[model samples]
Target: MNRNVILTCAVTGAGDTTGKNPNVPVTPRQIADSCIEAARAGASVAHIHVRDPETGGISHSTDHFREVMERVREADTDIVMNITAGGGGDWTPDSEDPTRGGPGTDIQTPAERHEPVGELLPELCTLDCGSLNFSDMVYINTAEWLREHARLVQQAGVKPELECFDLGHVWFARQLQQEGLIDGDPLYQLCLGIPWGAEADTETMLAMRNKLPDNADWAAFGIGRHQMPMVAQAMLLGGHARVGLEDNLMLKKGVMATNGQLVEKAGGIIENLGGRVMTPAETRERLKLRDPSTGKIVGGEA
Candidate 1:
């Protein structure tokens, strides 16, 4: 098992989850506050996604991103900022015509999807490795799109965390690395327990983790009820952990959880297991992330 672990708290997600839990942050101020709380609660990174404040819908507005970044960056506490570059891929077949995209469709060109990450130049941004049957919709990220997206992220000098939803995604991620599309050692996030994705279980995680490159830095999370259990499982297997409302809405059976609460709970699990929850500084060094303030890539391999 890894003695030192980095915990990431995904504050909000591009889902219809805002109505499911009252604690899900919608406004920029709220999202920033939640991220700060997670950092204070021992999260090394805050994985962020913005939503339309009034409608609680997923948004790709750079204005929303700007506000959230300004607040989080100017905050007193230190937390590695990770923005979603995986937006605008949600696709559903139109009811009237199956060939056409439906009302929920939010597809963006690779250039459009990379706009926020390109402008903000965050320490980290998501690089979804492949598409998946995300619930009833297909989150489309073609190989061509991913390769193009990787080039853009590399140009910005930002780290791209390969978000693998299944075994094939891991394969594609490795291919990206082999092609030198992703700079440095590839960082990975094994997204588990989403409907039609990899199962949130030990065997499945191990299978995915086994495919990672030798120098890979990886973290894993389970959605909904398996959130906490997967934390222990990942830690026991020497991998990092991720938690927050993006993947889970409840603290217990019927209790809604705040972002800080989830981070706190995950932190407790790590400490109780005699493991160290890494600080943001350590996380940067471990992940070889460039400092936004100093604009230099710290020298290390996680």
Candidate 2:
């Protein structure tokens, strides 16, 4: 295997993992600290998502995002921060009226979904493409909504990581690219192993990866037990890999893992495969990322 890879640490997700594992960070400070530790453990990027401090459920509050960003910035770590713009899409049909949302729904407009990303303007933010039955609940991301969010992300001068959960989602992402909704070399993230979406197997991964645009920069991740295997699979297939407590909480069966541990484990896997992990600076250069302030690729790489 080639010895050059980028490892992203999904520090904390917006999932309901807090109750399942007490080690999952709930507060902004805790999330920021976990990201810093992961960065120190060979992660080039930290994919972040904040939760309600009180309820521990997913939240898209600008205040919470600001807190997390400020804390991470204050630490002066070189890790590239990638905040999620994927929240507020959950919906449960009304038990009485199937056409309407039920009490558990948290649907919002595209503008509402972009609020946090607009506020933070992180180096990278996710843009989930297409919609699917996310397990029992529906993840509603209509084409109209995605176009609006993509425009906002472009205007903010942030790189939008196109997140595709299935083959159709990848096709929709390509459509967005064709429409010029996204800017620069499109960055895609193939999300696998979620229920009712793509499975986390080599065949599924390859099929999705082969469909990406020729000039695209992309990464792939698998949830649960498929996480580590996908790490090596992605590396061998000429793409980056992501791992963390958010995707897989266990280091082994019945054993919980911290964000740092997950990153370190992925790093070891990459190294063992003869791939050298890329640092954040190297990743920024390879991806041709512009300094948000200067609006040009920094460090003279471009």
Candidate 3:
């Protein structure tokens, strides 16, 4: 089991979850407040995704990202910021014409998807290692696109949390490392329990964890009901943990959970498992992340 754990609270994801949970942060101010709340509640990092304030839809606006960053920075407590760079790959085929994109389609080039991370330069950003059958839609991230995206993230001096939704993604992430696209020891986020992706169970998590580079720092999370359980499972398997409304909505059956509540629960689980939750500073050193304030890598890993 891992003694020191890093807990990441993904404040709000790009999914259509705002309508389902009232506590899901939609506006920039609300998102920033959630991050601060998670930080105070013992989250080492806040994985952020900005939404359209007016419509409560996913947005790629740099202005919105900037606002969220500013508000979080103005808060008293500190937490490592991990912005999402895996947006705009949704491809729901049109019902009328199978060849055309449907209404839910949101596709962008590597540069467009990396715009926020490139501009804001957060301590960490996500890189979805491969595409998957994301619910009814196919989230498209080709190998070519991934290599280019990794290069851009490396150029910005930001650490890309390789988000592997399946075993093949783990393979491709290793390939990226071998090709010298990823700098330093790679950080990984094993995503489980999404529709048609890796299953949320001990066996699957272990299999993926076994494939990771020995020197890599990794965390794992399960969607919906598996969120809390995966926290314990990840720690037991010698990895870190992640929690937030982005992956799960309820703290318990029929109870909507805020980001702070999720972080608190995850922290409790980590402590109960005889593992200590790492602080933001310690997480930076552990993950070799760039300091958000100075933009220099910690431990001289640059």
TM-score of each: 0.98, 0.96, 0.98
RMSD of each candidate relative to the true structure: 1.5, 1.7, 0.9
* Superior candidate under TM-score, 1 versus 3: 3
Writing each residue's lDDT as its tens digit, candidate 3 over 145-178 gives 9999999999998889999999999999999999
Q: Assess candidate 1 and give its TM-score to the true structure.
A: 0.98
> Model 2: per-residue lDDT, tens digit, 34-90?
889998898998999998989998788889888988888778677888989998899
Model 3 residue runs over 4 Å out of place are none
Residues 109-205, candidate 1, lDDT per residue (tens digit)? 9999999999998999999999999989999999999999999999988999999999999999999999999888789999999999999999999
Q: Ranking by TM-score, best first?
A: 3, 1, 2
Write out the backbone clash pairs for model 2. Answer: 3-275, 3-276
User: Total clashing residue pairs per candidate?
Assistant: 0, 2, 0
Model 2 clash number: 2
Please identify model 1 stretches exceeding 4 Å from their true place: 300-302
